[model samples]
Target: MKSFSDKLLWGIIVLLAAAMAITAAVKLSPLLNPPQDISLPLNAACDLHQGPCTTSLPGGGRLEFSLEPRPIPVLRPLRLQVRATGIKADSVEVDFAGVDMKMAFNRPRLVSGKEGLFTGEATLPVCVRNKMAWQATVLVEADGQRIAVPFRFETKR
Candidate 1:
């Protein structure tokens, strides 16, 4: 037979143990399943230049590009508008694998209630023509993670 005092003490002990268990479980939950890496699909629209063409991305969180009019119009340059969200990267590099154009930019650190927007311009190789459809892939890296997004366009003479 247990005394009343013993029962009271046991009840308190049980509650304390339960609390400790809950705390431990929550602390270890994140470790058990860490965040997985993910890549988003590329978002872009194609436009042809009558005199001067421009592609605009809203929310300042998108990339916009344009090409200059050419006499031969064989190859044209690509202008890029890049935006960063929830990141604090010191630098960023844009590489056009399909074409010979490559560029790098210094991105401003991410701030509270505001995302960093980067805009740059580059010229495509002169050999690129409308007959050959090309793919331009953009790689954005921040916080030790890299994301690749692709855009495609054809030049029409």
Candidate 2:
């Protein structure tokens, strides 16, 4: 009787462990195979508040990013635009993150336009501080490669 009970306990333990492993794998698969970010090597700096800024692509193209309504404001729907001159951009997404603080995941995919142009709308969350720093990363997928273009700017509340 004792031996039988021990075997049953072991079986239950094994099942629970297997279940946990499967759950972890499912949750972490995206992190393991996330889109390639090519922003580290090429730290392209741009002031989005100003009209438009252009950055050179890795292969051999130029990417221009612009924000509508000049002087970005928080809690407003701002029009974001991207135009890729040289690269064949299939998909484009903008990821916003607070540079000085940890905020929620805010990434919006842009609608592909004619040729290499992509447009989207995004709103920045309000912060407790008077001024906040943000980093907006433009993700471009072209020729089976995901390139990340990061830009930094500050906004006041």
Candidate 3:
């Protein structure tokens, strides 16, 4: 009778282990399969000159802007960085609002040993007292393709 009860207990444990294994497999099956891709429409557009200080693509490109203070009071300089893939431009330019400043940057190139990555920077004049927002844009022309990115910025008064 004791042997029979011991066998029953081991059988119950084995069954429970099998059930847990099946449950785990079912829960994880979705992860093992390829996910579906979702697409969205492009709303408005960015021109050679126009929105935010920084604009990022849905894919993997990003544009960043930074402000650097100059030695002279009330004068601020801006530094812009762009990292992108699959796009190349002949030139890039930036324009500031409420200030008569137009700065240009050279074309972007891949950092060594990396593919599809580009970076460049430009400096522009800014006023801290004015606290006005600024506008910037990027134009890329390569392989008969033209892409423009617009940006806006605001500095403290």
Candidate 4:
């Protein structure tokens, strides 16, 4: 026995409540389960062994990675230097893996050398193929959040 206006008011209230609920979910969903993998495209033509290569990071930061010994060699110690700008990181680590092969287990924690500079030593394993593609994933931890930046490069025998 509700009047027409009363029914219309109830309908509007229901719609408003539903809209608010959807908005809340959209805002809080990321916090509930933050993204784990964030793929960053190479903004520049980078030769990892030749010189320094830079990539843009989230939150207006820049990540630069350089490998020592101009041409990267397999089964040899390689020096990796990481430089970060405009971002504060508590710790940084590098994970090296084969791009097309199932080769893992090369995560090395870098030591801080100077302000915003991290250095570490890692070696690339030889693959069956004469030329192999590798990905170096740099994990930066700050403020209880982990950001992964991957850099892809190729090596030949």
**RMSD to native for every prediction?**
16.4, 3.9, 18.9, 11.4
Give the number of the best model, judged by TM-score.
2
Number of clashing pairs per prediction, in order: 3, 0, 1, 0
Query: What is the lDDT ranking, best to worst?
Result: 2, 4, 1, 3
Q: What lDDT tens digits, residue by residue, belong to model 1 across residues 1-157?
A: 9999999999999999999999998997654432324344554444434332222322234433333443314434444555555445333444443433332221222222225555555554443344544454444555566554455555444
lDDT of 2 by residue, 18-69 (tens): 9999999999766444567576343445677867888888778989888776
How many backbone clashes are present in model 2?
0
lDDT of 4: 0.81
Q: Candidate 1 or 4, higher lDDT?
A: 4
Candidate 1: global Cα-lDDT? 0.47
TM-score of candidate 4 on Cα atoms, chains taken together: 0.71
- Candidate 3 — worst ten consecutive residues by lDDT sum? 33-42
Lowest summed lDDT over 10 consecutive residues: which window, candidate 2? 37-46
TM-score of 1: 0.42
- Candidate 4 lDDT over residue span 22-109, tens digit each: 9999998764434655656644467786688888887788888888776888888989889988888777888888888979577789
Candidate 4 pairs with clashing backbones: none
Q: What is the C-alpha lDDT of each candidate?
A: 0.47, 0.84, 0.42, 0.81
